[model samples]
Target: MRFDISGHYLLLQAFDRTGRKVFGGEWHGDEAFARDTEDPSGVSGERRNIQDLIKTLAASAEPHNAILASDADEEEHQAASDALHQINRELGQLKERLATLPHVTGSWLADHEAFKRRTDIESKLFEAFRSGDLDLQVGPNEIVQWRTWSRQPDFKVLFSMSCVIVPRSHAGQRRRGPAFIQLAAFEKWLCRFAGAATGTEELTPEAQLEIWLREKIKGPKEFSKPVYRAHALEEIPELSARAFDRVWDNVVPKNWKRRGRHGS
Candidate 1:
């Protein structure tokens, strides 16, 4: 859209499917003159047309220049929109991965205190371990605690993760558990190391974790089916009992149920 002030009046112009003048009149900076120039099809509204026209005129000295400037502005806007969409897409993927991580709770960054604490942990971990100097090991079971020194400060860390196997329902059913527990833990460690080494705090913990998981770990060679549904039960306190109850219902021996139904 473009406009020019000539002979003490404003001339409005814009492009459409045909770029033809749908309506033409004199606007006196009042409501009635506005009504006179309004096109019911709304190829352009008075206020927006005027604003766009002003912008167009400010960009260049000639009407032809204004058209070129408007086209450039539109192209720039489209480029920005595409970039924003890409960022949002990547963010959604990060959130989904973060959701799969064990011990993740609440809407990401919703709780101020919890967010700060998590980020602090991420920062500390990144600082202590990014160099790959500290000795690290994983065991088959039971939580572990270790002490590490970095940044002229000592941090004591206690952390554990394991897959809770869900056995098959029938006689020949296979066992299953959530798949990403190990991956999540690995990513978490990498993100903390990144925070410490680079002093980058803007990226979400999840995004940082993803970068390290992909680049440093190169992912696990074997992929497993993830039991994502089980996480919902764990997240809501009211539903936690249901998870255990369902497991007992399925896994407890038939004789145990019969025995309980009858007597001690």
Candidate 2:
């Protein structure tokens, strides 16, 4: 009888004195039975004998030693062992070469740390902006400096100002309103600014009216002064009603239609 272990089961084959297969089966869990015999019912005796052999093998001190394999199995096992040994030797050589290389340290490490710090600060800055703790306004000079430094010829500084600073002809066009700077664009600009700004510099309010005006312009073509005042109060709590009106009168287009008026 020879036993071959294949995955989770054990295959058993018994040969007669003439080297002809007398019984063959597979053992699973606690059961053993003849599977390929000519007359399975008649081979009940053979099955019992095989089961007894399996039990004896299981009870052996080293159950693995009880398994039987042909010469081909031994050769395959030797080949696999040699491959594993070769892999280990190659890994050892790689480790030796890596150890001989210089240790990595210096400017690159400092640059990485600086990048991480900038990321963390930028995240906090954006969070503050979203939560209304920080305003979008910055000085005109600062905006100009950033615009020049960015080297983006198409960068619109009007979107960042407190008023629609474009020519009256451009302002009349619907596309060039403060609404042109969507929240996403504004946040992107903020992120870029955060990256370039020194950690010690403080941001100032420069575009509160422009921000409010943009939102209102996006909604209705006609709105009342009281409605505008109410929105200003809600959106720009830091600015007084008088200050809001002053900025509104100065920046609002003269030809803008009111709720009751047909023309400017």
Candidate 3:
């Protein structure tokens, strides 16, 4: 992926149990990401080794003007763009594939004591959070995540988490997963969408974490309510090795991997 990995930005996010932003900043480096050779799945990783560990992160760690000589030419630049496109496509496919699992709300979880979902809102809690109805807030940059809240062009919320987490299950065979939306963005986007008079009071990272923990423990129905089913990508059947090969073969140009095709 390095073929096109250069020059692009990444918004790597991290939050504690209470969904508070302990640290947040942009990460910029050609060598930012270390290799994860052991990860069976090609999705999220366990931790970051100090390249820049914080609560919020953007696509490129370095600002644009700062990368003058280091930036690639037009063709090389396109390759990076293409790489991002491919990564995003994989993320999309995985998200879709995981939509059929038992999940809970709160992008981050604390209590493992399972509960049941309620029909109070006439919809699931996750849907509500994503609907901008809750008007959530996360992190410093205030990236919001939702379709209805898409009106704000500068809003940087993640609509759904492309990654999957498989927890130690006591509930059943079904894998547990949930979509995530960052704090600052989620709140800001909701305010924009709902046209709220006053934006939310900025809370310290500790306070923010408490808010998120309260919400998670409270469950989907504003507290203590639970949502049983959710989008669980890990449970989705992985593409057969052969299928992956075939897709790659079709996607890669014939000559890209051809050496002995002409009886050389």
Candidate 4:
């Protein structure tokens, strides 16, 4: 099990007594984390460091007794839930306080200076960090997984923020190899989409490699959107044969596979 935080920013995985994955999730802040990633947030450096501890704990495969593993699983689940709840509550309080301020009306005209301030305030509120990064400070002894958060616009309003984690792992694998494989599959299908034929002919060094789309792409007859890409990849058999060596090289420890397996 692994936690995919802030999209691909971080991943946390845990295993149970029988080497079974127990818990996996993702965490990301609202505006702060997103803006920080695109830009930078010096303030969150200390908080991000907690990720190192989580990585260490997950890699250590100390055999877990049945009861101990169960207890640990329960503890982690409760901890994650409680932390999310606390964040929501804090954001709610902040919203109430901000709402007390008088609402200022501004000009609709873009050239007006008041209009500029009004637009700026609106943008900031939309991109404001609601209940995400701030609530998830690094705990001294535990990994806190953040589930959701909100952003403040104007005063008392609360907006629901959401994103998706694409499932990329195949059965029995706990890494992102599937994502890369999917991309490769898309590349292959894209070639056909652009009327490009696959061949064994030697290519020139100057040939550019990029997924191209034709001006008149008569996509799969059934649908109009990009869902056909998935269908096309599914029809191909070679995807399964594609090795996940790249993923393993980045994630697995050098020592774990080189030496004999360590067991209890």
Candidate 5:
């Protein structure tokens, strides 16, 4: 739906889920206004009009020179995501070939080396987590770890990651988060070893690991699928508030809410 997000938020009371607003606000002389509809092509048309307007201005200035244009950080992330895909595709193909191979040979050894290097990239990238790794053992379940790390001197944090390594026979099913998240490992080494960015035909280890973590280590829903459902928001609102506050600074609660009855 089209919106004039300028001025104050002209909040929509109850918009039709199926309805879309394409033309909004006053149309200038020959210019068209937005139309509202939930049609599949409607939003695309609205966006295309915006894009055309942007293109007219972009000719004179760089792509992101306009106020409405995306920031460098957003573009950087998009580039990284694209890089992740191209590298992993080759890894998938190699895994398929390895599955089909029967016996060991010189060529097989070379292929094995390729596999080892791929895993090593994942390992080395995440080696920093070792220093503050903690084993949080739960009864008869997969192991969980709380990794402690500090970036600047003032800020310290504990990040959680779990793992379950599987043999080749179970490689299809056994996937988990990246090995080195404990150490801030994924960032710096990523660009160096990333195959997708290289334009090299071979699979990139960095890209492969990205895919690996995505498929293996999902949200808590994916992690605890068999045993549980999602937790209530009230259960950890404070933690959630802290995470949100880091981005917005406004969401952080001022003073704790005292608990118990008797007007406590």
Candidate 6:
């Protein structure tokens, strides 16, 4: 599970015990969630750290119990008891800290249902664009506009469409243009839409690499970037070294340790 918060938007994704994705939701807020912090990246890192700690604590009980049940010396027993006590203390603190954060209240759909709804909306938008029924026209600074077929614009469709189609930097500009979108943004969105309709978006470089890493690497494994790159290329011939470097750290599991001279 992960909660990715940025400005007024939050994306939450969750997986079941078998690691199958069960829920995915995107939320929009009237006010920013991280107004007190200037560093969004830092907030993301902190969230991940908290999640890691939760996982670690959840798995620690058996090991600590084993030590207590064994014929260990007094010192060892004392250490295990102290560790369990510390874990409890941390868990209590975590609960209190989490309670202080602003609660998100909204409706959501299951993963499959959400995907179907999104695909249906994108297909309609794509068909409109392809049929030239949208009546696209060039606006200022490479922006594209279309005439609304109905008396009022279909804001719901436009809102859903823009979430996946519009670039984050140009989102504000879109609000100003109202009826406009960036032509520069169209190609990427078009490709994404086509891929979704055809079920090929999962084959993208980023998606492929994420799948590879999760399958090949496991807990406590030493991650050597050079070695991983070589293996990844063998598995995915199209993997770009520069692109891999750019996202390697972000995609790697939190518990993975760097090996050799870079190990920490």
By lDDT, who's the top model here?
Answer: 6
Where in model 5 is the C-alpha error above 4 Å?
1-107, 132-162, 165-185, 188-264
Pairs in steric clash, model 1: 126-192, 126-193, 127-196
Computed on alpha carbons, the lDDT of every model, listed in order, comes to 0.31, 0.37, 0.30, 0.27, 0.29, 0.45
Q: TM-score of every model?
A: 0.15, 0.29, 0.16, 0.15, 0.19, 0.27
Clashing pairs in 4: 3-12, 3-25, 5-27
lDDT per residue (tens digit) for residues 1-264 in model 4: 132221121111100100111111111112111221211223234334444444443343233233344656787656655655564565555455445533332321212332333333324323322322112112111222223312212112111211212123211232111111111122232232222233212221111111111111323134322332343235332322122222223223444224333211
Clashes of each: 3, 2, 31, 3, 16, 0
* lDDT accuracy of residue 177 in candidate 1: 23
Between prediction 2 and prediction 4, the one with superior TM-score is 2
Q: Looking at model 2, which ten-residue stretch has the lowest summed lDDT?
A: 6-15
- Runs in model 1 lying further than 4 Å from the true structure: 1-110, 140-264
lDDT of 6 by residue, 1-264 (tens): 221111011011100100121111231221111122232345446656777787788688668889999999999999999999998889778766665544322321233334444444445554655566432322233323323322233322243222222333344545332233322222223443322132223345654666456555544455577888887777777778876765466556554545552355
lDDT of 3 by residue, 162-190 (tens): 22223333213533223243443344333
Scored by TM-score, the top model is: 2
Candidate 2 pairs with clashing backbones: 137-206, 137-207
Model 4, which residues run further than 4 Å from truth? 1-243
Q: Which ten residues in a row have the lowest lDDT in candidate 4?
A: 14-23
Which structure is stronger by TM-score: 5 or 6? Answer: 6
Worst 10 residues of 1 by lDDT: 9-18
Candidate 4 TM-score to native? 0.15
